[model samples]
Target chain A: MPFEEKFHLRIPGPTPVPLRVQHAMNRPMIGHRSAECSRLVQKCSQRLQSVFGTRENVLIIAGSGTSALEAAVANTVAPGEEAVVVVTGAFGDRFAKIADRFGARVHRLDIPWGEACSPDALKSFLLSRPRVKAVFLTHCETSTGVLNPVRDLAQIVREHSDALVIVDGVSSVGGVPCEMDAWGIDIFVTGSQKALMLPPGLAFVAVGPRARKVIRQAEAPRFYLDLQAYQEQLEKETTPFTPAIAHLFGLEAALDMLDEEGLENVFARHRLMMEMTRAGIRALGLPLLAEDAVASPTVTAVRGTETIDATALQKELRRIGVVVASGQQHLKGKIFRIGHMGYCDPLDVLTLLSATETALHRLGKPVRWGAAVAAAEEVWSRV
Target chain B: MPFEEKFHLRIPGPTPVPLRVQHAMNRPMIGHRSAECSRLVQKCSQRLQSVFGTRENVLIIAGSGTSALEAAVANTVAPGEEAVVVVTGAFGDRFAKIADRFGARVHRLDIPWGEACSPDALKSFLLSRPRVKAVFLTHCETSTGVLNPVRDLAQIVREHSDALVIVDGVSSVGGVPCEMDAWGIDIFVTGSQKALMLPPGLAFVAVGPRARKVIRQAEAPRFYLDLQAYQEQLEKETTPFTPAIAHLFGLEAALDMLDEEGLENVFARHRLMMEMTRAGIRALGLPLLAEDAVASPTVTAVRGTETIDATALQKELRRIGVVVASGQQHLKGKIFRIGHMGYCDPLDVLTLLSATETALHRLGKPVRWGAAVAAAEEVWSRV
Candidate 1:
């Protein structure tokens, strides 16, 4: 079978893994209970603190970002408790759903799909819901390519109510700026498949001391996704369950790559790619779902015009070995998302813009031969 | 850094992953929502049916074996519901704990740590509990290296109560005989490690029609581990959440390898290795924890004598590049387990035996010379 080395993957997640991370994950398997694995787990957990921008030892769960979100919810909210979810996009709705499923009395604070939840709006929402146990917020609304002002919102949640401030940074943590402690984030979660530059399997949760104490006393019914067991085991440099061992190996390499690149540089690169992608998309005469003020550095959603269908454009891009994400849920056929997170660069953005131009030309839409690429090049030059 | 090519991975789970599978996992990443990934997930689920010896498509989750076990419990037992957990070893205790945490009326029928629950005992125990909702049983207890009589015990459960027969085949699925449908198993779960010849992370669960019905009505609070959502998305050839893409690639390769060497042949190879390891250990004057009649084909637990310390032997073997499992929980210093499943052959067992001899000598034990090797050679020749 042929390999996918040449294919350009621009999806919001399950992003392209670097060859180095792949090789790291391909190393020979070691015993999970062996001293070698124990040391590796301990080191990875410690290093992940730098990525999450927290002093707490991050707890790794062998599951998806959704699993991490569930861990945050399950550990903090019990049945009949109140949780306020800031529903900015699909992922916010997902958090709300999990809260409801766990029997929490959920109050969803809805914003426009591509809009960010302002701190004033959150403060007003939390004013009446004085008995809230936790407030779930999304750092990057992946489904709509919007980045919420999480630090500001978390600060508001802390002052207005007694709710724990939990943030989902799945698609933004490493690529976007996240200062968990300074932001007063009680619980922070991310996944390996997003900006972490690895396959989807492992979920990392960074919890503050207060959150850990709350998790211990929380009455939410849980077993596998419980955060308390993970913390206890993590204190001993092991996991409650057998971890995704190979992913941890890949994570070590990915973390080292991020360290070498420097956290500030990584965030800058993501911002540059997002700027380039948005500029190119705008030049192509297509509308963007998110505004510049709320645009995500990790992903950007572009809307289709009457002349060009988003679904058709996605299909055309895939046919040309460039894959992008189509609109999800109610926005189907309306927008397509381009991922500029982990393993992506200016060159990748240029390639996607070039492919979009070609796909548009093939769809009978008039396009200046290199208008999108030229716009992307202008951003590259300015940066 | 030097590779671990010569090291013997002798743990029960997190078994040695084959080089071919490792290379397969190193392939470039693809969009998880793309048609390619959809096809991959569908094909792997279908192919897994053969390994599980079931007609139902196995639903894969992005987590460890423990997560799969938790899924089974959380999806079937509601709060205040009755469930029977047959506790034969550590894993069985884990199942009971999960059930208990889920607020089920958990009845743990405890057997000796190193012994399997007898069919007669289970039959009589179930007779008094007519309202049992499910029975959790381990096919192979890795802690004690005992293979339970799942088929017979499941048959008895089917006859006596209306309880669903749930089996944990984490360390046995690809290397042991598990006729799920024939044995009347309602729900069966396993993980990517162990006999699957891959690093840990992905969990596979296969459910019968009856089990699905009960799970749909189950009142246990869950979101990430909700199997119903997984089943619905699986019907559309996708997952409810992001899957471990690289592990799925490795799983496809592992399944192909299993197909090449038929499932029966794979089981035979594991049995051969188990026999060889057990013979060598007995010849070295070590006592076997599990009786020969109930010994696991994938792993063998050998107890240390007064003159030999299991902990010291494990340390010495590791110094010589051999890794084995120490007894867990209460048996921490009494026994050492040698894994013989997944990528292990008679040669690997013989190499381990030689290392054991050397370690024993280093630890001031009597010189066995070539006694262990000779015994292993005799077993290898007979096989």
Candidate 2:
């Protein structure tokens, strides 16, 4: 009687864990200090390094993406240090808040919620705060469906100061292109739940040479989120504390699945699916939250009409077996987000569009039946 | 070629996740802001409250048990505030470290690693630190396999001072008896792993009225670990940030499984299994880590002979398909841990003891054949 209800995950993150991943998690338990666990740690770390495109150490923590971000801030920013955070959406603001919490003097460069920070804005922000030790940016903000120009911002930070560049690539890594070494990114961190098609519980942090040096000098108060401690233990293929072992099992399977698809093919697939979703939404006469050029290729945010309640529409969609995410804070109720990342294909896009058409019509938004699906079908046919 | 090998988890904290929990985790993702997610949150919170014996509020975070402990410290202790930590083992030291990380003035009442904190010692410590606002203690220290007297410590803290009594019940809650309200415990927290029979990703914090009031007054920079924000969103069955949804699903199933087994029966089974393990170890000429009165029924630490290479013995057992944890930090190479919590039964204890005896003998630690198995069979028959 307690679990009679059934629900499905179509939201952007914590996506339905793949069956293979779930099976991987069902393996017997092992001791954390054993050589076998250390071997796993070594193998998993190598996979993560290859994924992040870095030769430096990769640290895994038992928390969401935000906790990894906190570790980055607490380890890079010393007391009385300063940093520049380019804020375009909720996650960017979150990074800035974390820096502030670590006692760093944060200089925020705020942009519109649905837009990304311009490279020029970041350059000027760094120039104004000449003593800044780090520049924080989000590769793809899930809340507003915006993808920033991370390479350009990193270049700007390099030109203006000796500050390290940190990126929150939570929702973009597996679904989009992010070459950490090529972009000169000092630190790249992500969560397992997003594009990795794994359950939420583990976070990945990829450190570069500069970030490593900064961490050695950082004096921020930290214990559980300590990247240095993790790095040390990882050298022996273990964690400083007992980690979410089942998550590691699931992640190993996820990485295998990603390899089977190939990273490049996965990125291309995600982009094409996003196009299909966008074409479907645009065909229905709904405005996209951000301009097409700056919109993320992982999630499409459709600006709904004022007459329709986005929350109610989401609920109605759920009733019909579709799950979508609503906007946050200022953008709440103004737009509905459809995710096209991790385990998604053209068929998924079509199903969501069809559901959206029905929910819109049910809410009196006056969308034509089959029109959105037709647009999606056209994209799928070409694929 | 990279994943040609397979691994298992026989650790105490990140125990093996059951298939039922894994299936629950495979549920579709839901939007954190959606009403449906709020329902999931509400349901998980209510069930969590029932398990913790609390009626006030329970919050979930996407981290290991350590992250929850750090959050409790960051949310309960302000800068320059004073607190007392009863150190019975490594976990107690971890609490002190977390408190110091947040700039709290900490006073430690240190006890031997394999012993419980004396109620009189805690009272004396509180009497000495009259300005203390919190007293930290561990319900079960997985490191040394010692179970602290939670009720005794809580009573001492309440009687001696107005300090909030926080218990890290990560390894004990479901396996042993934890009467939060009757014991006057202000805060009780546990992780999803261990006796919960779920994967490691979710942690629960159940706060009583007094703990909630302390959180309201306590201020340290927090965002992701902000208990206030979690409580606020949890009131409506929502989370302030994106939670580990799949992990929650797993937790819901695990809790249901626990309920089906019945708490009293589960506790009894665990005790019976522990007794069987101890009897087997004694037959093998192994010394128990803790005194019988304070030993944990969940995990038992066995002291090995000076000539016995505990690490090699652990490896040999693992190679033969049995996994047990080696001691941590200073205790490493001297002690080995055997866990009998969550899904473990009398048969498992016998099998483990048999395998351990063979492994030790192979590693030059002599023991008569069938001695351990015979001892364990006798205990199993008696029970």
lDDT of 2 by residue, A1-383 (tens): 13424444567776766778878876765555666578777788788776677777889888888888888898998767888888888888899988987778998999988888888777766777888888899999888889898889988888778999999999987788888998899999999888888877788999998888888776677778888888788887889877777778778898999999998888889888888888898898888888778888888787866676767887787777777888877888888787888877888788888888888887778878999899988887886
Q: For model 1, how does the per-residue alpha-carbon lDDT over A140-205 read when each residue is reduced to its tens digit? A: 999999999998999999888878999999998889989999989999999999899999999999
Q: How many angstroms is residue A163 displaced in model 2 relative to the true structure, after the best TM-score fit?
A: 2.0
Which candidate number would show the highest DockQ if scored against the true structure?
A: 1
Task: Point out where model 2 deviates above 4 Å.
Answer: A1-10, A306-316, A363-369, A380-383, B1-11, B306-309, B360-368
Candidate 1's residue-wise lDDT over B80-103, tens digit each?
A: 989999999999999999999889
True contacts reproduced, candidate 1: 0.96
Reference-based lDDT, each prediction:
0.91, 0.83
Quality of model 2 by C-alpha lDDT: 0.83
Output the lDDT of residue A66, model 2: 86
Against the true chain A, what TM-score does chain A of candidate 2 give?
0.96
